[model samples]
Target: MIESDIKRYELLLDLLQKSKKEQDEQNNTLDQKCSSMINILILIITIQCGIYANVALLNEIASSEIAIIIKVLLIITLIGNFIALYFFIAAYYLKDFEGMTNEEDIIKYGENNTNLETIYKEISVDYKRTIEENKIELSKIDKIKLGFKIVTLTTGIFVLTIIICLEILI
Candidate 1:
Protein backbone atom coordinates (compact mmCIF):
# COMPACT_ATOMS: atom_id res chain seq x y z
CA MET A 1 0.00 0.00 0.00
CA ILE A 2 2.80 2.34 0.91
CA GLU A 3 4.53 1.63 -2.35
CA SER A 4 1.37 2.38 -4.25
CA ASP A 5 0.97 5.59 -2.29
CA ILE A 6 4.50 6.57 -3.14
CA LYS A 7 3.85 5.87 -6.78
CA ARG A 8 0.70 7.95 -6.69
CA TYR A 9 2.52 10.79 -5.02
CA GLU A 10 5.24 10.63 -7.64
CA LEU A 11 2.64 10.79 -10.39
CA LEU A 12 1.08 13.82 -8.82
CA LEU A 13 4.44 15.51 -8.61
CA ASP A 14 5.12 14.68 -12.23
CA LEU A 15 1.86 16.22 -13.31
CA LEU A 16 2.66 19.33 -11.34
CA GLN A 17 6.04 19.57 -13.03
CA LYS A 18 4.54 19.29 -16.49
CA SER A 19 1.95 21.89 -15.63
CA LYS A 20 4.63 24.19 -14.39
CA LYS A 21 6.66 23.67 -17.53
CA GLU A 22 3.72 24.56 -19.72
CA GLN A 23 3.04 27.64 -17.63
CA ASP A 24 6.65 28.69 -17.93
CA GLU A 25 6.58 28.22 -21.68
CA GLN A 26 3.41 30.23 -22.03
CA ASN A 27 4.75 33.00 -19.84
CA ASN A 28 7.98 33.13 -21.77
CA THR A 29 6.25 33.34 -25.11
CA LEU A 30 3.90 35.99 -23.82
CA ASP A 31 6.81 38.01 -22.54
CA GLN A 32 8.67 37.82 -25.81
CA LYS A 33 5.68 38.85 -27.90
CA CYS A 34 4.64 41.55 -25.47
CA SER A 35 8.10 43.00 -25.27
CA SER A 36 8.50 43.00 -29.03
CA MET A 37 5.18 44.72 -29.54
CA ILE A 38 5.90 47.29 -26.86
CA ASN A 39 9.27 48.05 -28.34
CA ILE A 40 7.86 48.46 -31.83
CA LEU A 41 5.08 50.70 -30.58
CA ILE A 42 7.50 52.80 -28.64
CA LEU A 43 9.70 53.11 -31.69
CA ILE A 44 6.75 54.23 -33.76
CA ILE A 45 5.77 56.80 -31.15
CA THR A 46 9.29 58.12 -30.98
CA ILE A 47 9.40 58.51 -34.73
CA GLN A 48 6.09 60.30 -34.77
CA CYS A 49 7.20 62.60 -32.05
CA GLY A 50 10.44 63.38 -33.82
CA ILE A 51 9.06 63.89 -37.34
CA TYR A 52 5.68 65.48 -36.75
CA ALA A 53 4.48 66.03 -33.17
CA ASN A 54 7.78 67.44 -32.03
CA VAL A 55 7.44 70.34 -34.47
CA ALA A 56 4.35 71.50 -32.60
CA LEU A 57 5.99 70.73 -29.24
CA LEU A 58 9.04 72.72 -30.29
CA ASN A 59 6.79 75.60 -31.32
CA GLU A 60 5.47 75.77 -27.77
CA ILE A 61 8.94 75.15 -26.32
CA ALA A 62 11.89 77.51 -26.32
CA SER A 63 14.42 75.12 -27.87
CA SER A 64 14.22 72.63 -30.76
CA GLU A 65 17.34 70.84 -29.58
CA ILE A 66 15.69 69.86 -26.31
CA ALA A 67 12.70 68.48 -28.22
CA ILE A 68 15.00 66.38 -30.38
CA ILE A 69 16.91 65.24 -27.30
CA ILE A 70 13.68 64.23 -25.61
CA LYS A 71 12.76 62.13 -28.64
CA VAL A 72 16.17 60.50 -28.48
CA LEU A 73 15.63 59.71 -24.84
CA LEU A 74 12.34 58.05 -25.64
CA ILE A 75 14.04 55.84 -28.17
CA ILE A 76 16.75 55.03 -25.66
CA THR A 77 14.12 53.97 -23.17
CA LEU A 78 12.81 51.46 -25.69
CA ILE A 79 16.30 50.10 -26.20
CA GLY A 80 16.74 49.68 -22.47
CA ASN A 81 13.57 47.62 -22.27
CA PHE A 82 14.83 45.46 -25.11
CA ILE A 83 18.11 44.83 -23.32
CA ALA A 84 16.36 43.81 -20.13
CA LEU A 85 13.94 41.56 -21.97
CA TYR A 86 16.71 39.91 -23.91
CA PHE A 87 18.63 39.20 -20.77
CA PHE A 88 15.66 37.70 -18.99
CA ILE A 89 14.47 35.57 -21.93
CA ALA A 90 17.97 34.31 -22.67
CA ALA A 91 18.48 33.20 -19.09
CA TYR A 92 15.11 31.52 -18.91
CA TYR A 93 15.58 29.61 -22.18
CA LEU A 94 19.14 28.55 -21.40
CA LYS A 95 18.05 27.23 -18.03
CA ASP A 96 15.09 25.49 -19.61
CA PHE A 97 17.16 23.78 -22.29
CA GLU A 98 19.71 22.56 -19.75
CA GLY A 99 16.96 21.20 -17.45
CA MET A 100 18.72 23.06 -14.66
CA THR A 101 16.03 25.60 -13.97
CA ASN A 102 13.95 25.61 -10.81
CA GLU A 103 10.89 25.48 -13.02
CA GLU A 104 8.35 22.71 -12.34
CA ASP A 105 9.22 21.35 -15.75
CA ILE A 106 12.63 20.57 -14.39
CA ILE A 107 11.15 18.18 -11.88
CA LYS A 108 8.85 16.59 -14.45
CA TYR A 109 11.36 16.02 -17.23
CA GLY A 110 14.41 15.64 -15.04
CA GLU A 111 14.21 12.20 -13.45
CA ASN A 112 12.78 10.54 -16.55
CA ASN A 113 16.09 10.82 -18.33
CA THR A 114 17.72 7.43 -17.66
CA ASN A 115 21.33 8.55 -17.79
CA LEU A 116 20.73 11.65 -15.69
CA GLU A 117 18.77 9.62 -13.19
CA THR A 118 21.65 7.25 -12.76
CA ILE A 119 24.09 10.09 -12.27
CA TYR A 120 21.85 11.85 -9.79
CA LYS A 121 21.13 8.65 -7.89
CA GLU A 122 24.85 8.19 -7.32
CA ILE A 123 25.20 11.81 -6.28
CA SER A 124 22.25 11.62 -3.91
CA VAL A 125 23.60 8.45 -2.30
CA ASP A 126 27.08 9.86 -1.90
CA TYR A 127 25.79 13.07 -0.42
CA LYS A 128 23.65 11.17 2.06
CA ARG A 129 26.48 8.84 2.92
CA THR A 130 28.63 11.78 3.89
CA ILE A 131 28.57 12.57 7.60
CA GLU A 132 27.76 16.20 6.82
CA GLU A 133 24.40 15.25 5.35
CA ASN A 134 21.24 16.62 7.00
CA LYS A 135 23.32 19.14 8.91
CA ILE A 136 21.25 21.95 7.48
CA GLU A 137 17.84 22.45 8.94
CA LEU A 138 16.45 23.08 5.52
CA SER A 139 15.62 20.14 3.28
CA LYS A 140 17.41 19.48 -0.01
CA ILE A 141 14.40 21.06 -1.65
CA ASP A 142 15.04 24.35 0.12
CA LYS A 143 18.64 24.38 -0.97
CA ILE A 144 17.68 23.96 -4.61
CA LYS A 145 15.12 26.74 -4.29
CA LEU A 146 17.63 29.02 -2.63
CA GLY A 147 20.18 28.48 -5.34
CA PHE A 148 17.64 29.38 -8.01
CA LYS A 149 16.59 32.46 -6.07
CA ILE A 150 20.15 33.66 -5.87
CA VAL A 151 20.65 33.35 -9.61
CA THR A 152 17.33 35.02 -10.43
CA LEU A 153 17.95 37.84 -7.98
CA THR A 154 21.37 38.54 -9.37
CA THR A 155 20.12 38.75 -12.97
CA GLY A 156 17.06 40.77 -11.94
CA ILE A 157 19.23 43.33 -10.21
CA PHE A 158 21.36 43.83 -13.26
CA VAL A 159 18.28 44.22 -15.42
CA LEU A 160 16.92 46.77 -12.95
CA THR A 161 20.12 48.72 -13.28
CA ILE A 162 19.51 49.04 -17.00
CA ILE A 163 15.98 50.19 -16.28
CA ILE A 164 17.28 52.75 -13.84
CA CYS A 165 19.69 54.07 -16.40
CA LEU A 166 16.81 54.47 -18.82
CA GLU A 167 14.85 56.38 -16.19
CA ILE A 168 17.79 58.63 -15.47
CA LEU A 169 18.25 59.34 -19.13
CA ILE A 170 14.59 60.12 -19.51
Candidate 2:
Protein backbone atom coordinates (compact mmCIF):
# COMPACT_ATOMS: atom_id res chain seq x y z
CA MET A 1 0.00 0.00 0.00
CA ILE A 2 2.88 2.39 0.74
CA GLU A 3 4.47 1.62 -2.63
CA SER A 4 1.10 2.18 -4.35
CA ASP A 5 0.68 5.54 -2.64
CA ILE A 6 4.17 6.63 -3.71
CA LYS A 7 3.45 5.61 -7.27
CA ARG A 8 0.21 7.60 -7.28
CA TYR A 9 1.95 10.69 -5.90
CA GLU A 10 4.65 10.45 -8.54
CA LEU A 11 2.04 10.10 -11.25
CA LEU A 12 0.23 13.14 -9.94
CA LEU A 13 3.44 15.18 -9.99
CA ASP A 14 4.19 14.16 -13.57
CA LEU A 15 0.69 15.13 -14.68
CA LEU A 16 1.01 18.49 -12.95
CA GLN A 17 4.33 19.16 -14.64
CA LYS A 18 2.86 18.34 -18.05
CA SER A 19 -0.04 20.73 -17.45
CA LYS A 20 2.37 23.47 -16.36
CA LYS A 21 4.41 22.99 -19.51
CA GLU A 22 1.29 23.27 -21.63
CA GLN A 23 0.27 26.45 -19.85
CA ASP A 24 3.73 27.95 -20.33
CA GLU A 25 3.64 27.18 -24.05
CA GLN A 26 0.24 28.78 -24.43
CA ASN A 27 1.36 31.90 -22.53
CA ASN A 28 4.44 32.27 -24.74
CA THR A 29 2.38 32.01 -27.93
CA LEU A 30 -0.16 34.51 -26.64
CA ASP A 31 2.58 36.95 -25.63
CA GLN A 32 4.19 36.79 -29.05
CA LYS A 33 0.84 37.12 -30.87
CA CYS A 34 -0.33 40.08 -28.79
CA SER A 35 2.98 41.94 -29.11
CA SER A 36 2.87 41.69 -32.89
CA MET A 37 -0.67 42.98 -32.95
CA ILE A 38 0.30 45.90 -30.71
CA ASN A 39 3.25 46.76 -32.91
CA ILE A 40 1.06 46.75 -36.02
CA LEU A 41 -1.48 48.95 -34.28
CA ILE A 42 1.21 51.45 -33.34
CA LEU A 43 2.53 51.52 -36.89
CA ILE A 44 -0.95 52.08 -38.30
CA ILE A 45 -1.53 54.98 -35.93
CA THR A 46 1.81 56.53 -36.91
CA ILE A 47 1.01 56.24 -40.61
CA GLN A 48 -2.40 57.85 -40.17
CA CYS A 49 -0.83 60.70 -38.24
CA GLY A 50 1.74 61.16 -41.01
CA ILE A 51 -0.98 61.20 -43.67
CA TYR A 52 -2.86 63.92 -41.79
CA ALA A 53 0.32 65.94 -41.47
CA ASN A 54 0.98 65.53 -45.21
CA VAL A 55 -2.52 66.79 -46.01
CA ALA A 56 -1.94 69.86 -43.85
CA LEU A 57 1.37 70.51 -45.59
CA LEU A 58 -0.22 70.12 -49.00
CA ASN A 59 -2.95 72.61 -48.08
CA GLU A 60 -0.28 75.13 -47.10
CA ILE A 61 1.59 74.61 -50.42
CA ALA A 62 -1.63 75.40 -52.45
CA SER A 63 -0.36 73.25 -55.37
CA SER A 64 -3.11 71.20 -57.03
CA GLU A 65 -0.80 68.36 -58.13
CA ILE A 66 0.72 68.01 -54.65
CA ALA A 67 -2.75 68.15 -53.08
CA ILE A 68 -3.98 65.36 -55.37
CA ILE A 69 -1.00 63.16 -54.52
CA ILE A 70 -1.56 63.80 -50.83
CA LYS A 71 -5.20 62.76 -51.13
CA VAL A 72 -4.18 59.57 -52.96
CA LEU A 73 -1.66 58.76 -50.22
CA LEU A 74 -4.31 59.32 -47.58
CA ILE A 75 -6.67 56.95 -49.33
CA ILE A 76 -3.94 54.33 -49.57
CA THR A 77 -3.18 54.71 -45.90
CA LEU A 78 -6.82 54.25 -45.01
CA ILE A 79 -7.13 51.11 -47.12
CA GLY A 80 -3.93 49.66 -45.67
CA ASN A 81 -5.11 50.40 -42.14
CA PHE A 82 -8.41 48.65 -42.79
CA ILE A 83 -6.72 45.56 -44.22
CA ALA A 84 -4.28 45.39 -41.33
CA LEU A 85 -7.05 45.75 -38.79
CA TYR A 86 -9.05 43.02 -40.47
CA PHE A 87 -6.11 40.66 -40.27
CA PHE A 88 -5.42 41.67 -36.70
CA ILE A 89 -8.96 40.86 -35.68
CA ALA A 90 -9.09 37.61 -37.62
CA ALA A 91 -5.61 36.15 -36.99
CA TYR A 92 -4.07 37.59 -33.84
CA TYR A 93 -6.96 38.72 -31.64
CA LEU A 94 -9.59 36.06 -32.15
CA LYS A 95 -13.00 36.78 -30.68
CA ASP A 96 -12.58 33.59 -28.69
CA PHE A 97 -8.81 33.55 -28.36
CA GLU A 98 -8.98 31.94 -24.94
CA GLY A 99 -11.05 29.08 -26.31
CA MET A 100 -8.08 27.56 -28.13
CA THR A 101 -6.60 26.10 -24.96
CA ASN A 102 -7.91 23.02 -23.20
CA GLU A 103 -10.36 23.58 -20.34
CA GLU A 104 -9.50 20.35 -18.51
CA ASP A 105 -6.05 21.61 -17.56
CA ILE A 106 -7.66 24.30 -15.40
CA ILE A 107 -9.31 21.80 -13.07
CA LYS A 108 -5.99 20.06 -12.62
CA TYR A 109 -4.18 23.36 -11.97
CA GLY A 110 -6.97 24.99 -9.92
CA GLU A 111 -7.20 27.89 -12.37
CA ASN A 112 -9.57 28.56 -15.24
CA ASN A 113 -10.33 30.78 -18.23
CA THR A 114 -11.98 33.33 -15.96
CA ASN A 115 -8.63 34.45 -14.62
CA LEU A 116 -7.32 34.57 -18.18
CA GLU A 117 -10.35 36.62 -19.23
CA THR A 118 -9.71 39.02 -16.37
CA ILE A 119 -6.15 39.43 -17.58
CA TYR A 120 -7.35 40.01 -21.15
CA LYS A 121 -9.83 42.59 -19.91
CA GLU A 122 -7.09 44.28 -17.96
CA ILE A 123 -4.89 44.29 -21.02
CA SER A 124 -7.65 45.96 -23.04
CA VAL A 125 -8.03 48.60 -20.30
CA ASP A 126 -4.27 49.39 -20.36
CA TYR A 127 -3.61 47.25 -17.26
CA LYS A 128 -4.00 50.34 -15.06
CA ARG A 129 -7.31 49.24 -13.60
CA THR A 130 -5.92 45.91 -12.56
CA ILE A 131 -3.00 47.59 -10.85
CA GLU A 132 -5.29 50.05 -9.13
CA GLU A 133 -7.79 47.41 -8.04
CA ASN A 134 -5.23 45.19 -6.37
CA LYS A 135 -5.02 45.12 -2.56
CA ILE A 136 -2.59 47.49 -0.84
CA GLU A 137 -0.81 44.53 0.71
CA LEU A 138 0.15 43.39 -2.76
CA SER A 139 1.90 46.71 -3.42
CA LYS A 140 3.94 46.27 -0.26
CA ILE A 141 4.79 42.73 -1.29
CA ASP A 142 5.74 44.00 -4.74
CA LYS A 143 8.05 46.61 -3.23
CA ILE A 144 9.76 43.92 -1.16
CA LYS A 145 10.14 41.75 -4.23
CA LEU A 146 11.53 44.67 -6.25
CA GLY A 147 14.06 45.44 -3.52
CA PHE A 148 15.22 41.83 -3.42
CA LYS A 149 15.53 41.72 -7.20
CA ILE A 150 17.51 44.97 -7.31
CA VAL A 151 19.88 43.79 -4.55
CA THR A 152 20.45 40.45 -6.23
CA LEU A 153 21.07 42.01 -9.63
CA THR A 154 23.39 44.63 -8.21
CA THR A 155 25.38 42.04 -6.26
CA GLY A 156 25.77 39.82 -9.33
CA ILE A 157 26.83 42.71 -11.55
CA PHE A 158 29.30 43.99 -8.91
CA VAL A 159 30.84 40.59 -8.56
CA LEU A 160 31.23 40.19 -12.31
CA THR A 161 32.65 43.69 -12.74
CA ILE A 162 35.14 43.16 -9.91
CA ILE A 163 36.27 39.87 -11.37
CA ILE A 164 36.70 41.42 -14.81
CA CYS A 165 38.57 44.43 -13.41
CA LEU A 166 40.90 42.20 -11.41
CA GLU A 167 41.59 40.04 -14.41
CA ILE A 168 42.36 43.13 -16.51
CA LEU A 169 44.58 44.63 -13.80
CA ILE A 170 46.53 41.38 -13.36
Candidate 3:
Protein backbone atom coordinates (compact mmCIF):
# COMPACT_ATOMS: atom_id res chain seq x y z
CA MET A 1 0.00 0.00 0.00
CA ILE A 2 2.83 2.41 0.83
CA GLU A 3 4.51 1.73 -2.50
CA SER A 4 1.28 2.37 -4.41
CA ASP A 5 0.72 5.63 -2.54
CA ILE A 6 4.21 6.82 -3.46
CA LYS A 7 3.64 5.94 -7.06
CA ARG A 8 0.36 7.85 -7.06
CA TYR A 9 2.04 10.94 -5.62
CA GLU A 10 4.76 10.71 -8.28
CA LEU A 11 2.15 10.53 -10.98
CA LEU A 12 0.38 13.57 -9.53
CA LEU A 13 3.60 15.53 -9.62
CA ASP A 14 4.15 14.61 -13.25
CA LEU A 15 0.64 15.79 -14.15
CA LEU A 16 1.18 19.06 -12.31
CA GLN A 17 4.42 19.65 -14.17
CA LYS A 18 2.68 19.02 -17.47
CA SER A 19 -0.04 21.51 -16.60
CA LYS A 20 2.56 24.12 -15.76
CA LYS A 21 4.30 23.55 -19.05
CA GLU A 22 1.03 24.04 -20.93
CA GLN A 23 0.37 27.29 -19.12
CA ASP A 24 3.84 28.55 -20.04
CA GLU A 25 3.24 27.75 -23.69
CA GLN A 26 -0.07 29.62 -23.58
CA ASN A 27 1.56 32.63 -21.99
CA ASN A 28 4.21 32.76 -24.69
CA THR A 29 1.60 32.58 -27.43
CA LEU A 30 -0.37 35.44 -25.84
CA ASP A 31 2.73 37.61 -25.77
CA GLN A 32 3.42 36.98 -29.42
CA LYS A 33 -0.16 37.85 -30.41
CA CYS A 34 0.04 41.08 -28.44
CA SER A 35 3.25 42.07 -30.21
CA SER A 36 1.77 41.36 -33.61
CA MET A 37 -1.35 43.41 -32.81
CA ILE A 38 0.82 46.33 -31.76
CA ASN A 39 2.60 46.27 -35.08
CA ILE A 40 -0.70 46.17 -36.99
CA LEU A 41 -2.05 49.14 -35.01
CA ILE A 42 1.06 51.20 -35.71
CA LEU A 43 0.73 50.53 -39.39
CA ILE A 44 -2.96 51.46 -39.42
CA ILE A 45 -2.33 54.69 -37.54
CA THR A 46 0.41 55.68 -39.96
CA ILE A 47 -1.77 55.05 -42.98
CA GLN A 48 -4.63 57.05 -41.45
CA CYS A 49 -2.29 59.97 -40.89
CA GLY A 50 -1.18 59.89 -44.51
CA ILE A 51 -4.77 59.77 -45.70
CA TYR A 52 -5.72 62.67 -43.43
CA ALA A 53 -2.90 64.72 -44.89
CA ASN A 54 -3.94 63.99 -48.43
CA VAL A 55 -7.59 64.75 -47.69
CA ALA A 56 -6.65 68.00 -46.00
CA LEU A 57 -4.78 69.12 -49.09
CA LEU A 58 -7.96 68.87 -51.15
CA ASN A 59 -9.58 72.31 -51.26
CA GLU A 60 -13.11 70.83 -51.52
CA ILE A 61 -12.76 68.95 -48.19
CA ALA A 62 -12.83 72.15 -46.20
CA SER A 63 -16.33 73.00 -47.46
CA SER A 64 -18.08 69.60 -47.80
CA GLU A 65 -20.26 67.65 -45.33
CA ILE A 66 -18.73 64.37 -46.54
CA ALA A 67 -15.33 65.78 -45.70
CA ILE A 68 -16.44 66.48 -42.13
CA ILE A 69 -17.73 62.95 -41.76
CA ILE A 70 -14.51 61.49 -43.17
CA LYS A 71 -12.43 63.59 -40.78
CA VAL A 72 -14.55 62.46 -37.86
CA LEU A 73 -14.18 58.82 -38.83
CA LEU A 74 -10.43 59.26 -39.17
CA ILE A 75 -10.24 60.82 -35.71
CA ILE A 76 -12.25 57.98 -34.21
CA THR A 77 -10.02 55.42 -35.91
CA LEU A 78 -6.91 57.08 -34.52
CA ILE A 79 -8.37 57.18 -31.02
CA GLY A 80 -9.50 53.54 -31.13
CA ASN A 81 -6.16 52.34 -32.44
CA PHE A 82 -4.35 54.27 -29.71
CA ILE A 83 -6.59 52.78 -27.02
CA ALA A 84 -6.03 49.26 -28.35
CA LEU A 85 -2.30 49.96 -28.47
CA TYR A 86 -2.40 50.88 -24.80
CA PHE A 87 -4.10 47.57 -23.93
CA PHE A 88 -1.50 45.60 -25.87
CA ILE A 89 1.29 47.43 -24.10
CA ALA A 90 -0.30 46.71 -20.77
CA ALA A 91 -0.63 43.04 -21.67
CA TYR A 92 3.03 43.00 -22.70
CA TYR A 93 4.08 43.91 -19.17
CA LEU A 94 6.31 41.13 -17.88
CA LYS A 95 4.97 39.13 -15.00
CA ASP A 96 7.32 37.69 -12.39
CA PHE A 97 6.20 34.09 -12.26
CA GLU A 98 7.00 31.76 -9.40
CA GLY A 99 9.25 28.89 -10.41
CA MET A 100 9.54 25.36 -9.15
CA THR A 101 11.41 24.44 -5.98
CA ASN A 102 15.12 25.13 -6.13
CA GLU A 103 17.57 22.23 -6.10
CA GLU A 104 19.31 23.63 -3.02
CA ASP A 105 16.09 23.74 -1.07
CA ILE A 106 15.26 20.18 -2.15
CA ILE A 107 18.74 19.03 -1.07
CA LYS A 108 18.38 20.76 2.27
CA TYR A 109 15.02 19.12 2.85
CA GLY A 110 16.44 15.77 1.87
CA GLU A 111 19.31 16.04 4.38
CA ASN A 112 17.00 16.85 7.28
CA ASN A 113 13.89 14.83 6.43
CA THR A 114 14.48 11.19 5.62
CA ASN A 115 10.80 10.29 5.24
CA LEU A 116 9.88 9.83 1.56
CA GLU A 117 6.20 10.65 2.10
CA THR A 118 7.00 13.91 3.89
CA ILE A 119 9.33 15.06 1.14
CA TYR A 120 6.84 14.22 -1.59
CA LYS A 121 4.13 16.10 0.26
CA GLU A 122 6.32 19.21 0.56
CA ILE A 123 7.33 19.11 -3.08
CA SER A 124 3.77 18.62 -4.24
CA VAL A 125 2.67 21.61 -2.19
CA ASP A 126 5.42 23.72 -3.72
CA TYR A 127 4.45 22.68 -7.23
CA LYS A 128 0.79 23.52 -6.61
CA ARG A 129 1.76 26.95 -5.28
CA THR A 130 3.82 27.75 -8.35
CA ILE A 131 1.04 26.60 -10.64
CA GLU A 132 -1.41 28.95 -8.94
CA GLU A 133 1.02 31.81 -9.22
CA ASN A 134 1.45 31.11 -12.92
CA LYS A 135 -2.33 31.20 -13.35
CA ILE A 136 -2.26 34.73 -11.98
CA GLU A 137 0.31 35.74 -14.58
CA LEU A 138 -1.86 34.25 -17.30
CA SER A 139 -4.66 36.64 -16.39
CA LYS A 140 -3.26 39.15 -18.87
CA ILE A 141 -4.47 36.88 -21.63
CA ASP A 142 -7.90 38.51 -21.52
CA LYS A 143 -6.51 42.01 -21.99
CA ILE A 144 -4.56 41.06 -25.10
CA LYS A 145 -7.51 39.22 -26.54
CA LEU A 146 -9.69 42.27 -25.98
CA GLY A 147 -7.11 44.41 -27.74
CA PHE A 148 -7.13 42.13 -30.76
CA LYS A 149 -10.91 42.37 -30.98
CA ILE A 150 -10.76 46.16 -30.80
CA VAL A 151 -8.11 46.32 -33.51
CA THR A 152 -10.13 44.11 -35.80
CA LEU A 153 -13.30 46.15 -35.39
CA THR A 154 -11.50 49.46 -35.82
CA THR A 155 -9.58 48.26 -38.85
CA GLY A 156 -12.82 47.36 -40.55
CA ILE A 157 -14.20 50.82 -39.88
CA PHE A 158 -10.97 52.38 -41.15
CA VAL A 159 -11.21 50.48 -44.41
CA LEU A 160 -14.75 51.68 -45.00
CA THR A 161 -13.74 55.27 -44.24
CA ILE A 162 -10.85 55.05 -46.69
CA ILE A 163 -13.11 53.69 -49.39
CA ILE A 164 -15.55 56.55 -48.90
CA CYS A 165 -12.81 59.17 -49.07
CA LEU A 166 -11.33 57.62 -52.15
CA GLU A 167 -14.68 57.60 -53.91
CA ILE A 168 -15.19 61.26 -53.11
CA LEU A 169 -11.72 62.26 -54.22
CA ILE A 170 -11.93 60.41 -57.50
Compare candidates 1 and 3 on lDDT and give the better one.
3
TM-scores, in order shown? 0.32, 0.36, 0.86
Whole-model Cα lDDT of every candidate shown, in order? 0.45, 0.46, 0.81
Cα-based lDDT at residue 3, candidate 1: 58
Q: Pairs clashing in candidate 2?
A: none
Q: Enumerate residue pairs that collide in model 3.
A: none
Query: What clash pairs does model 1 have?
Result: none
- Model 2 alpha-carbon drift over 4 Å, by segment: 1-27, 39-43, 46-57, 95-170
By TM-score, how accurate is candidate 3? 0.86
Which one wins on TM-score?
A: 3
What TM-score does structure 1 among the candidates reach?
A: 0.32
Q: What RMSD, rounded to one decimal, does every model reach?
A: 13.0, 21.0, 2.3
Ranking by lDDT: 3, 2, 1
